[model samples]
Every structure is written in structure tokens, then in C-alpha cells.
Target: MSSFRLITEYSLWFILPALCVAGAYSWLLYSKKGPWSPLLNKILFSVRFILIFLLCFLLIGPLLQYIKNEFEKPIFVFAIDDSESNTISTGVAKLSALKKEIEQAKKILQQEDYTVDIVTLSGKLSIDDITFKNPSTNLDYLLDKVESNYENRNLAGTILFSDGIYNQGLSPAYKELGFPLYTIGLGDTAAKKDIILKNILYNKLTYQGNSFPIVAEIQNQGFEGKDITVIIKNKGKLLDKKIITFSRNYDLKEVEFRLTSDEKGLQHYEIEVVPLEGEFTDKNNTGHAYIDVIEGKEEILLVASSPHPDIKAIKSVTDQKENYSLNIYIPGITEFKNEKYDLIIFHQIPDLQNTAAEILNKYGKDNSSIWYITGNKVNYASFNQINNALKISQRGQQLDQVTAVYNPDFNKFSLTTEEASVISKYPPVSVPFGEFKPMNNAEVILFQRLGNVQTVKPLLLFSNANDKKVAVFSGEGLWEWRLLEFKETGTTKVFDKLIGNLIQLLSSREEKRKFKVYPINSEFYSSDPVLFETEVYNDIYEKIYGQNINLTVTSEKNEKKHYSYVNTENSRFEIKGLSQGIYKYVASTILNGKKETSEGEFLIKELNIELINGTSDFDLLRTISDKNKGVFLPVTKLSSLPEILKNSSPQSIIHSNEELSEIINLKWVFFLLISLVTLEWFFRKFKGGY
Candidate 1:
């Protein structure tokens, strides 16, 4: 059962050194020899010289002998691992103890005549004469290597030392190898107390007059049922703050905030959550968002011929917002400047006898929103001359028998058979109007015929003629609703919304008088084409125009791109797919030159969402190991891994069994010696030694 293994690598140069030593010894012995000597003495001296020469050869390091007791039984391989994570806790101590245990096991195996192969499975594996580098601590890979290498040898068992964490290589099933897994876990299992801001989200851009929302998610670990505060700020001003409560155990909470733009350019803001005690990192607690607020203030010019409450009501609403600057010019006011307004409203203006029609035609040809309100005091013939779409005819007298009712229910308003078809294609809304003559070159928005009334006309209509937009209202019943049901039902909000909807429509149409261009960001380059858009609406929120509109662009630099409007429902016109840079655009309808000019500016900005730190506790690693029947050892148990592996006997198997005669060839050694001796004797006989 005991055996010695010798391993040596010698070159032909070694033979030269042996020859020199032999020559030197022979000279020293022969240099002192007498010329004549007894034959017996000579033979004795020769035998002694041969023995000395063999001893000298042994001392020259021809080969090295490693002797040890080898067990006649099968061999078992012990693999030990040393990796970075294994040093987390008592890993070093565990590894040392495991080494001692393996040594003891080896001694036991030797005494029992059982072969044992000691291998270190650190970053790699090392056997008696073979070594593998950077070998993963994964027991599966190591076992597979062993199984393959020792396929024809008798392998009694295998022992592995490692920290339970197997970060590299596939985790194989111990059952597949027909072995048991004894995993030694390492590292601390206590959850580290920490708080993290999981995520943040917000809109990239917003209009100057609009408000946007921001959302964020926060997660807490080790602290539950706790209240946390989140705060949002712009520049140095505190915008909003909220307190949120977290559920017991680790919980993820969501928070939302609203932000409104105040200027006509870029608005920057920061959102952050107040950190709790023992929070891990503050990097994730805060984030920044940027929004571009476009300038969209529209100038409206009012030209009312007669004093009326409707104009005052409309002015009151329009003038209340700084965004809408209203310039009123009633009839008989000749000193008013004509070019100062974006929209012109005509109230019961009977005629254009004082060059007013010429001025209006000029303005209309230049593209402007013109609103006409019909009344009894107006000369319909003269007004029709300027805008013939009104189709006004002379009447013998002004009739006052018509009484308008406040209809709260939108369904009660009856539409003519022809008008019903158009109304059916759109979203339904309550419309208020009086009967008027339907004219050619005009699209009717609303229609109604009073009972016993001879005249039946369009209540509302839009006309595109001579590159001009004309909007006509047949009757005035808007205030009646506010006074009657609005006051009775106390649903003032609904009434306000209705009025707001109407105003939004009229103002949006008038916005085409000037082009408004907005940049996507503050740092926008001047070479980029600005984004141009507008919202089109009717007085009653009824969408009269498609969301898709057309815009003719002209820049100070003489650049142009025809943009087709994309309808974003709710009367918004969006012109997308634009190049980056500064530009001036005139947005308008193709039928009319009415355009709103605005400067375009945009800056390219990159938004980044930070990654969540650490990992989830779903135990994905454990699941993977369990699925493969591999041992899942915590980082802390890595120290005692050797003992655990030893207990498992993971490598207990016979890789191969072969007869001793196959390994050792005694016949070959004897044959080599006989051949050398025969040659030597033949040389001596040829020299006539007899």
C-alpha cells in the first residue's frame, strides 16, 4: 500500500555534467595508482569505483523522489476554495479548520489503505501534480472536472471547501452526480437598515400657461410604518411638500406633485425626499426635471358698432387673464390704430360707409379672426357687402316677438334634418342660437327654427372667403343661461366651464393671427426648427375644426418648412418631426393667411433615471440553486465549508479501475538492462578480454 512517486525533467546537458564528474573521479583514483598491481586488488578497486560512481550520480539530482503511503482502495478528491467574498466573516478561520480536517481525513484514509487526493479549490483547483487557475467556487464545475479527469480511476469521494456564494458557473444538481451537498453559508444575514429613493418621473416639456404633474417612487427597508416627507422646489422657492406613511416591512411608496409654468421659456425644478435616519445613500433621493413653457399671448381687437352686453361679457372674460390682451374699438371710434390687434369682433355693425369695410378687408386679407354678431340695429345689406357669406336680406321691420329660453339640457335643442347630419358626426353639446339665413360658402355649426317663425337660418357658422375667416352668431342667448338655470340650479361651475370652453375656441382661432414658436429646451441651438402648434375650438367646446391643421412657415433667415398639423383631440394642433434650431414660424389655415408668429428655441437634454441600489430579496439566486439541487450557502457559512463538504463525501466515486500490471511494466525495465549488459559484454569480447 505504500508507494513513492518521482517526478523529474532532465536535458542532455545533464549528461555532460555526469560525464565530467566521472572523468574527474577516474583521474583522481588512477593518478595515485601503481603501474603494476595484483589482479585481486585491481578487481576490488574496480568494484569500489563503480559503487562510488553510482552514489555520485544519485547526488547530482537526476530525479526527485516523493514518498508516501498510498492506499490500495479507491481515491477521494478534496477541493477547497478561496475567494473574495469568502473573507467577509469567519471565512478565514473556517478555511483553516477545514484544511486541518482534510489533513486528518487524509491520514485516516492512508491508515485504512484508502487513496486520497488533496486538492485546493481556492480561485482554482490544485491536485498532487496538476493545478487549475481561477477555478470558480462552484462545486458543480469542480465536480464535473474531477469526474471527467478521473473517469477511469477509482474515486472514493470528493470534498469541497468554499463560501456558499457561487457567483460564477452553472450550479449543478448534487443528485445528478449521485452525491449529497453540504453547503457552508457565510456572511451576515441581518438586513442592512437603509432607505432608498427608488425612482422619479416627470414630463419633459409644458406650455407656458399650462400645469403638469410629476411622480416619484420611494422604497424603505428595515424601517416600516414610518412617515416620510417629500418636497419639491424650483430655484430657491419651495413649491410643494407632502407626508407619506409606509406600511410595515419593506414597502415601496408612490408620490405625486403638480407644477405650473409661469414664464414663456424653460422652467427647471427639483424633486427630493427627506431622508430618514440610517438611510444608505442620498444620491437617489433627488432628481431634476426641465420643461419649456411656450409664449402664447394673443392680441384681440374688438370692433363693435353698437353698445351691447355680450361684448362687455366677452371682454370681461378675455381681459381678466394677462395672457389675453384685448383692444376694443367700437363704431364711431375713428382714432383707433388698426394694426394693434390679432382678432377683430364686429357687433351689429350695419355698414362700412366710413372706410371701415376697406380696413376690415385689408385686415381680413392679411389673415385675422373676424367675429360678426347680428342685431336689429345693423344694416344687413351693407355688412353683407364686406362679407357676403352672411346672406342678409332687407326686412320691413325689426321684430321683437322672438323670445329665447335657457335650455340646460343639451338634448332639448332640436337640429334641422340637414344640421342633424353634421352634428351627429361630432360630440354633442348644448348650443344656443337664434334662426338666421344659411349662406353659401359657409359651414353651419348650429341651426334652429322657432315655432311659427318664417325665417330659418344657421345659428352659428364659419366662412372662408378671400383668404379671410368669418364667424357669425345668429342670436344672443349665452347670458340667458347664466341668469336662469345657472342661478337656479346653483351649478355655476358648469356654466363657467361652458363659457370657458367657448372663449377657448374663439381665442384659439385668433391665435393664428401670430405664429408662436417654442423650443424643446433652454439650451436649444439656433439651427433647430422650433415646434409650432395651436388649439382650435368653437364657442361651445364643440370641436368644429379637425385637430389636424396646416401652417405656413417663414423665418427671418428665409428658411421654410410646411408643417401639417396632427390633431391631438381637444382641439390641439401639434406639428412634430422638426429639426433642432432657432426659427420663426407663421401658423395658419391653408384657406386663410391668418397666422400667429412665434420664435422657436430648443435645447437637447438627456434625461437619466438612476439605478436602484442593492438587490431584491426575492432570493433569485437561491431559487436557481434549489432548482438544480445545488447547495445554497449564505456568505457567512463559507468558513466551515471544508468540514461540510467532507461530511457530504461529494467526490466518493470510482472514476476508473485498472490492474497494476497495466501501470507498471517490470518486463520492460529487465529487457532494457539485459540489452545494455549484452552490448557491454560483446564490446569486451571484441577487445580480446579472454
Candidate 2:
């Protein structure tokens, strides 16, 4: 187990000369008139020769090699699946038995001189404080933990116990753990009698006073000649209910119902299936959904100098949207008294005759966003005075037809690659001959193209400044662009989406609230973190921290929990490990001697992966065990793990390390050389021969 060697990279021919020099020095020092005995003289000459030999050998830079042995005990990783799936009645009763089996296995492995590490697998992997309350199961996450924690150690093998029903992530079978595995199968393999509410389909947004549809997928087994009632409710009030009749023992049904959205803001709804007489589990009989209802029909007003085909083209797009109402007017001839529209369109207005100067000046700085379209009739000096978005220096009154070139860097919103490609090839639009100069704050969505030449002119510009949002299109004849877009593509949906993005961007109002609280997700997969953000703005609309935001969560069981936290960066707060259920929360904070409160609801849905099929996949366990050169055992026979590992590969790893040492730098060598020279001197003086 241990050895030493002297080595050098030089040729062997130099060793003879080095020894001869050491012989000559020893004879000159000790062969002269010395009264010492022949044995003493031989000993002195030998020591002298050896010392001088080593001193000469230093020139060759000799190295000493030492080899040592290191003993490493075999490592065994034992992971327990501590997810909610194992908490069902079938697995719940076996908890004590599982613990006993694992304990016996651990004791036997330790007796075999193996290092054991136990871990728990769930939504997240942790130490072996096994709690079967994790709402989700991620088997690969546990394997990743084993790989990270046991790397660079004497890892011999791994043993796992689970039902083999993984949800929320990839299966652990595919992960290359690079070690043999021994799997113990858990959970029942026979199908259980259960009725499950599989999934729901509905829209998240709808108009108030209108009915929306909700659809549910229902799956049932072993429940023939039975009726299951599906009910929908809101705020503890029943909205709709229906009974489903099964035609066969195993049935799949789709049920649809309509409910009126009569309230604004976020509305919470619950959907449930009445539990059958002999169902396996009832925790999955209910689910939650939400909808947001808003006011109907955004009002859009279009003002122009006279009736043109462009007015009809713009109206065609807005008219198709059930949520938009379009009204038209000829600026000087029409009576435009109402200012309640969400957005105003100014086309060739504010001419030398001052057609819409008053309306344009009033809305240029206010909150109502405006869109401008320029043409030959738009008076340059008067238009600049009315809308401060863009300036134009006209060389003549002539109108030039130019095609559109889309800007890839425009950030107002996104346009699909196909739409951007199609719009770039559209027919030319009419623009007054001039140099179009947009302000610094403006973002150009499109630039002007003269034939094949693209120019740095604002064909379409958007700006938000002075608390106002404005969009200007320095051209007309968009009716031509619409026609060309339809010609290129079979449908106008692409063009419609382009126009819709513009309208949606312009119609959106900024949030000016001083106090706000929002959740990252209103619905979470059980075991997911429940997070909320809180913001308190001063009178100047800047966020300030150091205030306690008290949050209260009320469960459906009428249980209330209180929590208080102070806001940090970006006014954020998060809580984790919430179970599956519907709950309402209220956030309250004191601001400027006044208390403000906001309320909302969130739902944590259960990870129904285990419920998807109660039957365990023993074949999956067999495949994994066999693939890793391991064996599979039932939950009842896990006690033989230690004997199996004793006969496994790599019983005990004996590690070896090689270390190098310099002969010249060895302390013992230096001390021995000095002692030898001192001994010879003392002996010669004692004999009166020096």
C-alpha cells in the first residue's frame, strides 16, 4: 500500500560521473594520516561519498515519489416519495410499515459499512423529514438532487420507493444517474371506482350583461345507472346545475352551461361534481374558475375634412368589432358636440380654414389618446400649431404616392412576421411632397418608400409625452393598403390584427392608482408559492416602502389567517406551501392618515396526477430498475436491500494518491549532511590527526 522511488528526467550516463566526483572528495578528506580503525575509515568515507554524491545529484533535479492508500466507504442513496399521491387511503395506512422497512434497510446497510443518505422527494427535494403533504410530485427533481449531493463521492447505488405516478415534471427514468438502482413499488395497481372532473374550458374576459359559456370534461368509471350532478356557483350562489346520465360503466361527458356576467372587475366562480355513492376520493370533485367583465363597446370618433373612401375603410374595421362603436363626422359641416369618445381620429383637419383647431388643441394635451392622418389638404403651419407631435416642411402642394416600409425596431407593440412582410409590399399611400420631421420622442412604426428607395421619413409615428398618447400617420389612402393586404393573404385577419394592435395600444389607459396590490398568479398548482405585490405611492405618484401591509386570507371553510409584511424592492411579498383550495384575501395599509383596502381571490388546484390513474405503473419501475442494472422489489420485501448491495458492483473503493518530493529541499537530508561533516572533524581532532 506504500512505496518510494527516486526519479529524474536526465540521462543515466551522468550518474557515473557524479559518483566519481564524490569518491575523489571522500579520499582526499579521509584517506590521509588518520589513526582511526579501518571500519571507521570505511564508514567515514561512505558517509562522505554519499553526501557528496547527493550534492552532485542535486544538479540533476532528482524527485522522490511516495504512494499512499485511502479507504472510502461505499455510498447508498435512499429517497422517499413524500408527495400527496402517497397520502391516499391506500398509501396512508402503509406509512408506519414503510417507515419500519426503511429503518431496517438503513440499519442493515450501516452494518455493511456503507454510508447512507436519506432524502424526501416532492415538489421540491429536501432532507428525510418525510411529510406526505406536498401537493405535487417531481421525480426528476429528486434525481437531480441525488446527482448533485453525491457527486465526487464513493457513490455505489441508489434505492427509491414511490408509486411511479409523477406529475408536474419529466419522469426520472430518463435521467442518467450513472448508478445501479433498486426500486420498491408502492400504491395499488387495480383501477379504483372514482369519478373525476378532468378539465374546464371558458373565456377569462367578457362584456357585462352578456352570457358566457363554460364547458367541463367529466370522466367516470364503474358508475353505471347513476346520475352525477354538475353545479356552478358564484359567491356562494348557484348559477347553473345539471345531472349527467351514464350510458356505460366507463363514460366521458362534456357538459356546457351559460352564465351572465353582470359584475365588473374580477369575478370568482366555482364548479363542482356531486360525489357518487362509492367514489374513491372526493378531494378532486371541485374546481375554481374566474372571469373579468368590463363595460361594453369602446366609442371611437373619426373626424375628416370630407367623405372619402378612407372613412369607409376605417369604419369597416371598427364596425366588425362588437366591442367598438364608430361614429363619423365632416369637421366644418358636422356638429361635433360630444367628447365622451375613448379615442378621436383627425384626418386632414386643422387646415387654413381652421376646421377642427378647437377640438385638436383641447385633446392634444389631455388624457384621451388621438390618431392623426395627413394628406395634401392638411395645412402645414396650422397643423403644427394644433398637434405638436410632428413637423413638416412642404416643398410644394403636390401629392406623391409612396409604399410603406415597416420598422423592425418599433416597440409600441408587436407585428407578426407574416403581417410585416405583407404590409411591406402594400400599394403606395399618398403623402404631401415634403420633408417629414418627427420629434425626438416619437417612435416611427413605418417609414416612407419612394418606389424601391426607402427614406428616413415618418410614415407612421407614435409618441407619449406631457401625459398624452398620440399616433400620427403622415399619409392617407389606407383603403388601398387594406385592399393590397387582402390581395396578398387569403384572409383579412392579418390586417385586422395589425389595426387591432394599434387600437388596443392607443385605447389602453395608464394606471395612476396610488395604492395597488396584485398577485403573480390568481391560480396555482398546489404546493406552488402564493405571491403578491404591494405598492404605496406618495402624493407625487412615487412608490415608498417601510409600511406594513396586513394581508388576511379567508378559506372556504370560514377559517381566517392574518399575516403582516413590509414591502421590499418593487414592493413585493411572497408566501409558499399553500394547499389546494379556494380562498379570498384582503390587503390593507394606512396611507396619509387613511386606511385603504383591496380584496381578491385565488385558488390552488390539486396535482391530480396520482388521481389521473390510481393504478401504479409497475412496468415503469421494472424498466428503470433493469435499465440501471438493478432489481425491483415490492413494498413488502424492501428489507433485502443490504444483502443486494453487498453483492453489487464496487464493494469498497480503495483510493490511491501519488505525491512527489524534492530531495534537495528535504529537511532531514540537510541535517544529516551537517552532522556527518561535524562527526568527521571531531573524530580527527580527537585522534590528533587534523
Candidate 3:
């Protein structure tokens, strides 16, 4: 039972002031009557006596009624947290026990004539309902609701059941509710012994033959000072492996590996750390990455009406370092066989003879990539017999003099929507060009207008029809860029990058049967299993099977992961995940138990931390309970909580009551009277109140 007091007890102090005033009034009347007062004095004394009687009546604070009901009953409230994190380990069992205890306590409170309220902490609010079903746990939300709803009700105490893992709510301990908190902790306190791949970092895009870095983070618990091996493989071939030690307790270790693009198109890389002994799940031990590689080297056929510096300049740029191979065909002299190149560039071919027109048509039909460069000598008549596919006008005109303009700003050309996919990175600028329209299947890569000429033509274009690709340059001034700007460097790096990019774009043919493998990281352990898988795609993007594929996995430590393909009824080819060390894998189809291979390679990374100490530390629970004035009970003692709870009581409510006369002192009234007298005196002297 809680204690209570009444306001009437504080009114006793008013009696002294009333008696003083009455006595002073009686004395004053007697003194004014010269100590011989008669009826008038007696009447004044009687009035003082009545005033004293009234004052005493006011002093005796009254109450209509006063009652006290005392019993051993105590109200109890159970606030339970039912969040997702609470579902770990033996949480359900602990929660069940907590619920049973709450029910038992509710019965006890009811037997003692005390009210019990059950509040569930979840995504929403509830009262007196102990179903305790919620998708989330929010302790602060429940407390706020309780504070708002139960403000007038006298709460004896509160009990809390949770895992101490609060993500969506405020701290319940921070609220100053003047109540004792009894917390029941749920879930396992021990740190779990496990290994997890924390992260995998790699580039989104890579160029063919370029080396890219792959970084992996390995997090380990309970394993320290123990050597672990990580292995990497592609398809099934072992690429690399490394062995490393881990730190005590739980720590994150980083491993890096280098991956090279072997074939064009999309390349898939898988990196995995070998599973440690006594680890949880192996799913987190591996990660996957993908990159797109466009073919860079291309064979280009150049056909021109006359040999000029423009052709030489374009050839010089294409021929360096085997980026692109350029073949020259003069219009009248050479009757060329059209079988050798991916793209064919035409420079001012003036005559549309039957043989040349037929060749052009054949080139277009064969899907041979082509480029048409227009100059003063060329007219529509020269290209008209070729089915007018080039969109060239037929009127030929001779120019007296054409000045080459070297505009650095021509390199900043922006790509249209159609060209953005392939030509996204290159800046486009106006190049000097003559008149010509791109073919129906052609896309303009660069455009320019000739000396304020109303007709603007494509300076560079690509066509996809007939399996052919064509690039058209409508001017001859590009050669001057090399001489005026590049000098001995052939052309500026920007121009080189442009040519390199163009070659890459034109030569990119989706691989008919190709597979690429990459290791997530470079280092691996010999004891760790190497993971390798290939995403096989047909020429048209339909998934295909590499049945009975043989993958030869080799490790730097002489470990191997060779395996014959065991078809899993799927197109993907995979090998066993590996351990610490640098490893590689080469995958191929096996015929008669022999490796009849295509292509494959990969790398495996190692874990960095040692495994001396076990993962997890349970000291946090004790620390938290100690800091918050709560008891940290063991899991076994959870069922004996009712007795401890019954013993605990609500915090004492401390109040300091003062008498009314003490609060309303006469000194304030005396000061006021003195101020009024001074004001009256000042008014009499100066006609103003002070």
C-alpha cells in the first residue's frame, strides 16, 4: 500500500497570526478609551473576539470526507520488447518463460486487489494486452504511450524483457519517471565463432588486357594466431593462393588481388575465402563480380580516290601498337578482295564505276564496317550507283582553295542517345567535312559543317547492317591536326584515345562461345577451398551449357582443384570453394578424360586475422546492468524472477510540505503598507504619489 497525506494538516500554522491580530485590535480599542472603556470598548472587544473566531474557523482546514484503505496490494506493469533481433538463439524459450512469469504476477496482483497492466513494445502501441506479437521492438514508443495513457494511475513498478538490442527506439532508462526498472535479458551472451566475408570491392568496367584490382575483407570471430589459407580459381582452374594468420577475438582483415581481362564482352569473377573450422555458414565466404570488356584491336580497310596526307595521317594513328590494321585501296587501280577487315574507310572515291559500286554493295551486305570521307573531288554521282546508301548528293564541284582549320574545341562533341552506350566517354568536336548522310543503319559519332555550308554531314559514322560497320569522315582537315598540334607524337593523346575508342567500338563482336573468370582477391591459403564459376552465354545471349567441362585449378603452393564437370542441370560451371593462397583455374571441356579446353583463370584470397581467441565476449551484459542499477541474471535463473520482482518496489516519492502562514508571511504586507504611507505623504507634499 502507498502512503498519502492531506492538505488540511498544513493549515495549523494560520492560528498564530489570527490570535496576534485579534489581541492587537483589542489592546488598541482599550488604549483609545484611556483604559476606562465602557460599552463602546466592550463592543470593539466583542468585534475583535468575533474576528478571532472567524480566523480560527479559517485556520481549521476542512474536508468533506477523509478515508484510507491500506492493503499489501502492489500494481505491476510488464513492458516486453518483441523485435526481430530477439529471435536469436534461445530467445523464444526465454520469452515464453517471461510471459509465464508475467501471467503469474498478474494473478498475484489480482489476488492482492492490485491492478496489473501489460504493455507490449513493438512497431505499435497497446495496453493491458499481453499477446506480445510485433514485427519490431521500440521501447521508447511503449514508454511514451504508457506515460501518456497512465499519467493519473499510480504505478507501483515496471518490468522489462528484451535483448538490449534496440535499433528503432530511444533509451527507456533516460526517462525520469521515478520508477524502479527490473530488466530480463534474452538471447545468448557468448560471441559466435564464425567467419564472414565482410566486403568485395572492384571496378564496374574494365578494358581488355588491362589489370584491375579486386579487394576483399574477411571478418573472423574466435580465431586468432592460427594460419588459414585462401584459394582463388576461375571456372575450375586454380589461379592463386596465400596463407595468413588472424588476430585474437573478432577482427576484419583485408586482402587484395589483381585481375586481368582475358577476352572481350562481359567477364564474371568469383572470389572466396576458404571456410574455417567451426565456422557458421560458407555462404558468406564467397562473393561475385562482373565487368564488360570491349575488343580494342580492329582491322580497317582504307579506300581513297587519291593518296593524300589525310589517309597517311589516319593510317599513322591506326597502325601504332597494333591497335588497328589499315589497308589502302585506290579507287581505279585496285580491285580489292573484300574479305579482310572489320571497317572500311573511303576517301573521295570520285568514280561510281560498275565494279567499285558492286564492291561497295557487297561490302555493305557482308556487314563490313565502312567509313566514307568526303572531299572536293568527290560528288554524289560517284556514290549514287552504290544504291545511294551513303546519302551523298550527286553534284560535283571543284574548290579553288580549302584551308584546314585546327580547332582544339572540336574534341568536345557530345553523343546522342543512340551513340551514348558505346561512345559515352569521348568528347565530340566539329571536324571539317563535306556533305553526306549516314546510311539507314548507320549512327553518327561525329558531325561537322563545312565553312558555314547549310548542309551538315557526319564526320564519323558506324553502320550495323549486312554485318558491316562503317565510319565516314567528310573532310580532309583532320590530317592537319597531327602536323599542327601533335607534331612527332602523331596525334594528341585525346586523338589517340579517340582512335583507340573507335577501334574498340568497331571491332567489338559478341563472342560466340566465351567465358571469363576472375578472383576476388590475389592471395589465398592452401588449406582453403577455391571457388570458381563461369556464366556461359551463347552468341545471342541465350545461356548455353559447357557440359563435361574440365577445369584445371593450379595454386602457387602447388595445390590443385582439378575437377570434371558434373552437370547440375544448369548452364553455370562451378568448382569447390578454396582456402588461403594465390590460385588460378583454366576451364575446358573434357573429351575422353582429357582437357579439351576453351579459356579460364581466377584468384583466391586469404584471411588476415588469427584464430587464437574465440569469437564473442559476454561482459557487455554485466556492464550494462551494473550501469543502470539492474540485476544481470543468468539464463538458468530467468525462471526465478517472480520473487525478485515482488521484492522490488516503486521509488519513494519525496515531498517537503510547508505551512500556509510560512508561505504567506506578513513581512511582505508590512512592506506594502510602508510603501503606501510613503506615497500618501509624497502626494500631500507635491500633489504626486511616490
- The C-alpha lDDT values of all candidates are 0.52, 0.79, 0.55
Candidate with top lDDT is: 2
Count of backbone clashes for each model? 51, 0, 87
RMSD of each: 27.9, 7.0, 21.0
Candidate of highest TM-score: 2
Model 2, TM vs. native? 0.73
Each model's TM-score? 0.35, 0.73, 0.34
Full candidate order by lDDT, most accurate first: 2, 3, 1
- Write candidate 2's Cα lDDT for 394-419 as tens digits: 88778788888889899878787877
Q: 1 or 3, which is superior by TM-score? A: 1
| Candidate 3 Cα errors over 4 Å, as ranges | 1-194, 199-222, 233-241, 247-271, 278-282, 289-339, 346-367, 375-388, 391-471, 475-690
| Candidate number with the higher lDDT (2 or 3) | 2
